[model samples]
Target: MKEERLFSLRNPWFVVSAGGTALIAILSILVGFVWLPSVHSDFTANGLWGAICSAAGAPSSWYKGGDNVADAPPSNVVVLPPLGIARVNAVSSGRGATLATQRCSMCHGVQSPAGVTAPFLAGQYADVIYKELRDFQSGARQNAIMQPIIASLSDQDMHDVAEYYSSQSRVVQATAADGHDDSVARVLSMQGAPIRNIAPCAACHGVLDRKGAAPWLGGQSAPYLATQLRSFAAGNRHNDIDEQMRNVARQLRPEEIDSLAKYYAAQP
Candidate 1:
């Protein structure tokens, strides 16, 4: 009687098959963990054209005349996993305060007003700074896009660092609507032609948020202000609730953009 042999994995043929399968599986996992991100990002960029084409009811992949990689950062340099803008759990706890004071204060002055563009870090909440620093590393927060610089910090280090900054007081902006007049007031008051059916910039950000994290506008540098506006217009900067900038920026002429920049840069 011929007995049916069990499919023994120990057989040479079976060993080779099993080994090949194992190797391929491992390589696949390695690629997923390490390689595929760059590929996917580039592909998604290309796919954007297809999306734009559909938006315009066209068959071609081109959108608005051509493809724009202008705002897209080099994904190859970005890290994966926690690679997104997110708020940290909490700020400086028991022992982390010292680190924050020594490190963070160097950039942002130790005083209440802090440095020129940097906000005062006296009594602000820790979570806000944590989120911001994390956002800088994760590429979620696009304002600075300080990627490699922030990515250098460990998770625990980030927590301590964010906690320290959060503990500092963020500068509060005061509006004296009647005091003086400039392009700041012009844009905020809607003194010029209506832009994108949008009203003045002051109409929204004029008031402070009890929620925290509303960036102070009046004291921010003109270049910073212009960069933020352009980012909003280009859709590179999202996450704002009302899309205040996107609408406003799209409506601005080049000279008007420069005008706003010059005006805000001169504010006290």
Candidate 2:
């Protein structure tokens, strides 16, 4: 009778103990699988915590533009030449042309050979040209071909080359029809895909307003532009100031990329 009394399911102490164990099991399942994981997932998706963690882990000299602040050497500051193409002078152009023939014409040419795929430098903004050269020389940008070539150049040489290229007239190329909606590219260039957090290409690339060091994309080659966009999306091109290109490229679809490239290449 004593044993029966102690072990009975009807006893208040036995019932209380069983209830406590069940409660613990339920809480454990909720906390371990559901609550904790949900919290972590939310934190990751929001990126606030992740950014903080990344900042904490990064070196003190790391700049938001991916440059090492302490290691960066002084570069010649580029000032924009006056609005018209008339600012290109005979002496400067001659010097630049001579340098181009000696070094740059093999790859980037005023008139490239058939099937040559390098970006045409003609009519590009001088500031943009200078910045790219600087980035390449500093190792802030990596290009197997460009790095070696730029490494041999002095700051004055870069400026001279940039002057030559920016002085030449741009040739508008024929863009292949990819059968995608042209409006999509147009909208992205002018208005941007706000839903995807993309800024208008014109905001930087100088159709609407020129931003600092933004290149003129008006007559850029379609294939070259497309390749660059894809590279940025893939994280292969990391030299853009503030990860701007990376962020925009990552949000683009394949069709959008093709369309935008075509649109810009067709522009005069």
Candidate 3:
């Protein structure tokens, strides 16, 4: 009998094991590098090498000349960390209150009566209010009603008004009568759908972690909130810095939007 080497190709078991391992490696590479990245809308594959490079966290392949370039910044406002931290002074708050009563009361005031869909301004972050006013003034946010009103507001006036709103208490309103449908909204708010790249609503909306300039959603009207979500999803509202809201909104289902809106509206 001839002595046989354990690692030799002549060994049937060795041959089978090696072939199986090779097949698995090939399948993994195909799935991880090609199939996974191809599913995202933004993926730009230059070729096999490009796909591999992107999947491996490497720079674009040398063959990629101008195929997959990033778009320009989407927002005009540059939100700084220190923004919205200013305490409300009596003088500024008083001026802001006067402006709110005279100019903003028609839509935003509590006494506007029922069936109104406009967002309540009370308890909103000052930075959020100021940035939105600036966007309205700059034509970055389009609204026939708001544009003309904001156009005449000076920078100081915007600041005063924002501070005033921030100082006011959140509107005291009735919570949603139905708690059965709210569980979906609560789940979305607390635990986001990671597969869809949607972060938890609480991350930016002040439940878990608050991003700068992100507004407080508690006590807002359900109709107003739902309308805004629809606008964001439809690309009608794109003023959110870095396309953050737009991206999240686009991934949300219509039912999810309704649920989220109702959930926030019910909060105190």
Candidate 4:
């Protein structure tokens, strides 16, 4: 003659089981929607790690937006015929010289002075110079300093400036005062760490072979070069075609970055 329950709603066992199931379901949803996506996004953004993981066929959520490797944007870099050393010298005496004097010399120096806050442009490849200018003007590259200066320049102006700089004599800074051997930097520059998926700096910078629109890094300013490497590593600079610099820079340790900058700065 006990009162019979209509349902299990009042049963302690049933309540516990139902509550546990609800908690499990909520956790599953969070893992699927929130946690998993965040992990995937981080993996994808880590350039060197992503490359390695991708080669190993690790499962990862697809990157959204236009960041997919297969759908990378067309390179804005243009390969121009090499501006011969003689030609650069000749053009530097003309309109190119005028432009450099008026605009570029403030930061880059007139004939490539050493130890400036900005990278020395003298003796840099004309195509490299022109491409950087174009990138700055087109908003492909973001720099608080360069963007405003390049905004008013025409394509022809860029070319003229490039020619002038390419022709000028290169200025070499004194070796790093720290007296470190810099063997690590030399190895990274000449022979990249293949295991880390870093390509040799020489490959693109013309120390070994010249590639399309890659600048000559030899004799660049150490402070400027270090700043740039750090910028690339931190993803603050995204102007490199195909994420080349960004990927390589991120893999470099702080000591390595300092060494590389010093090594290149002292080059002739």
Candidate 5:
């Protein structure tokens, strides 16, 4: 009996198999670690090691809080403490009412009439309004109209304005007369597409569980809702924490987005 060296390159089968495996590994490393991360602006500055780590799905902000970048300019608003529950007193509400009447009423009030797509501020959650205002002021969320309007408002003024609008009555439209079938939208809202990593809309937007700063979508304008969904899908609006709404919007089809908007608009 003769003993043979299994790893010997002289063996044609062994050489072919080993060479193929090495080639595959080299290609995989180049594509995954080099090519993929180079396209992303955030990871490009970090160089080769950053690309390798990102490809492995490591969290990118782990080292970002260091003292080196501390003096660097802030990329986004710091949303903490201010987003907490705001107290609505008579004085605050009065001041808020004055501000809203002077600054916000032209678009959001009853005098503006129907067919207007700017979001109805009446009966909105104070926290939701405040967060959005803060985002607009800090440039985390951009709007030509909102940014300038929110620019002059101080922190207390925003809080007051949010409180005032929240105290007003929500306008409830005749959803039954609208004659739009929304069974699919109802399903999407109540029980999200778990397979696609989408959470139920009600989990955050009020019903099952209300996460912090999540707004109630019921009674919102259909056009506004649809536009916002499209914006999120296109990555134009991304103030949502951890890209939650962005992920869901990206998964929805065009028809589904329209249906969901109509469904929520019809809610009492």
Candidate 6:
């Protein structure tokens, strides 16, 4: 009986037939709108093929703890507590910055005093950069394009890069939109709506002692921020843990996203 069961389960023909039948039954249970159940995420979630299959509406792929394949979420985004602005006076001159240029620029690449698609990493936060790298490495930031590049990095490498970028001085540059004074402009200026309750762009992003997963906003291209915030709000960027960023973006009045993007872009 066990051998017979194994034969049925292992047979490709039987498996495909059964899967199709089960899928039809599922549609019927949903009252026949050509419905398919959403893919159930699990600990064993693997590569593109597995994700594809599951998204095709496979059944019974879950384990008891949901998606805790190897570990749980961290209480903090970094290995060490962030050194606030006061501690900036204490670190060795240019040491962390040098390490970042060596290690991180391997993937991120250095600026040419020109321009490129890869992000310029100078002046970013240690914690925010660290979290992104960790998420990429741990499958939390799943992407067919990025997963492999980040998968091999050691934990220490991530920390070193974070510290390096955070220590650099921000450069100044302004965009054409910087000249505009529309409703979007008023919001970024912190003169409107929830901006009153939410705090200034400088408070979390433009300041020296900002905590949490916020990255630097200075000199970030307005076009990029505008697209990214919209992506998060619309669920196009769903790979983030807890979707904290998506939640943040969703709170924006449509104009607020536009305003914040223009605001950050105009920063030098």
- On residues 134-231, what C-alpha lDDT tens digit does candidate 1 reach at each position? 66676765644246556677777766665555455545343232233464446543443341244565444444222334343554445556767777
Residue-by-residue lDDT tens digits, candidate 4, 75-151? 47666667443344564547788988887788888885744577778887788888888888887777788888778
Query: Which candidate wins on lDDT?
Result: 3
For residue 54, model 4's alpha carbon misses the true position, in angstroms, by 8.0
Encode model 2's per-residue lDDT on 1-268: one tens digit a residue: 4454755687889889988999999997677556755755422332544434543565324346865434223234334644233344667678778888887888787543222266778878877887888888987767888888768887777777788888887765554533334887999899986635689999988768887777887666678889999988987777777678888998788988988988887777
Q: State, as a TM-score between 0 and 1, how close model 5 is to the true structure.
A: 0.68
Writing each residue's lDDT as its tens digit, candidate 5 over 148-252 gives 887899889999998888887888666432556687788889998663456789998888988777788888788889999998898888788777788889878
- The reply for model 6, stretches above 4 Å from the true place, is 1-118, 178-183, 188-192, 195-203, 207-209, 238-243, 253-255
- Worst 10-residue stretch by lDDT in candidate 1? 74-83
Give per-model TM-scores: 0.45, 0.65, 0.73, 0.69, 0.68, 0.54
Using lDDT as the measure, name the better of candidate 4 and candidate 6. 4
Q: Which predicted model would earn the best TM-score?
A: 3
Candidate 1 lDDT at 122 equals 51
Off by over 4 Å in 4: 1-75, 83-93, 175-180
Instruction: Assess each prediction's global lDDT (C-alpha) against the native.
Output: 0.52, 0.72, 0.77, 0.75, 0.77, 0.57
Using TM-score, rank the candidates from best to worst: 3, 4, 5, 2, 6, 1
Residue 39, candidate 5: alpha-carbon lDDT: 60
For model 6, how does the per-residue alpha-carbon lDDT over 1-268 read when each residue is reduced to its tens digit?
3444544877888899889999988876564222222332221224444534545666335577856564334323343346443233325325445555555566454331122223556666667777777777776554575676556666665665666666666554445656545655545444323312234454545454454676776567677778777977876665444565565666566767877777666666
lDDT of 3 by residue, 116-222 (tens): 48778887788888888988888777899999887788888988888888778776566552243577689789887664568899999887989977888877878
Residue 172, model 3: lDDT of: 54
Candidate 3, residue 91: lDDT: 94
TM-score of 3: 0.73
Identify the runs in model 2 with alpha carbons over 4 angstroms from their true place. Answer: 1-89, 111-116, 175-181
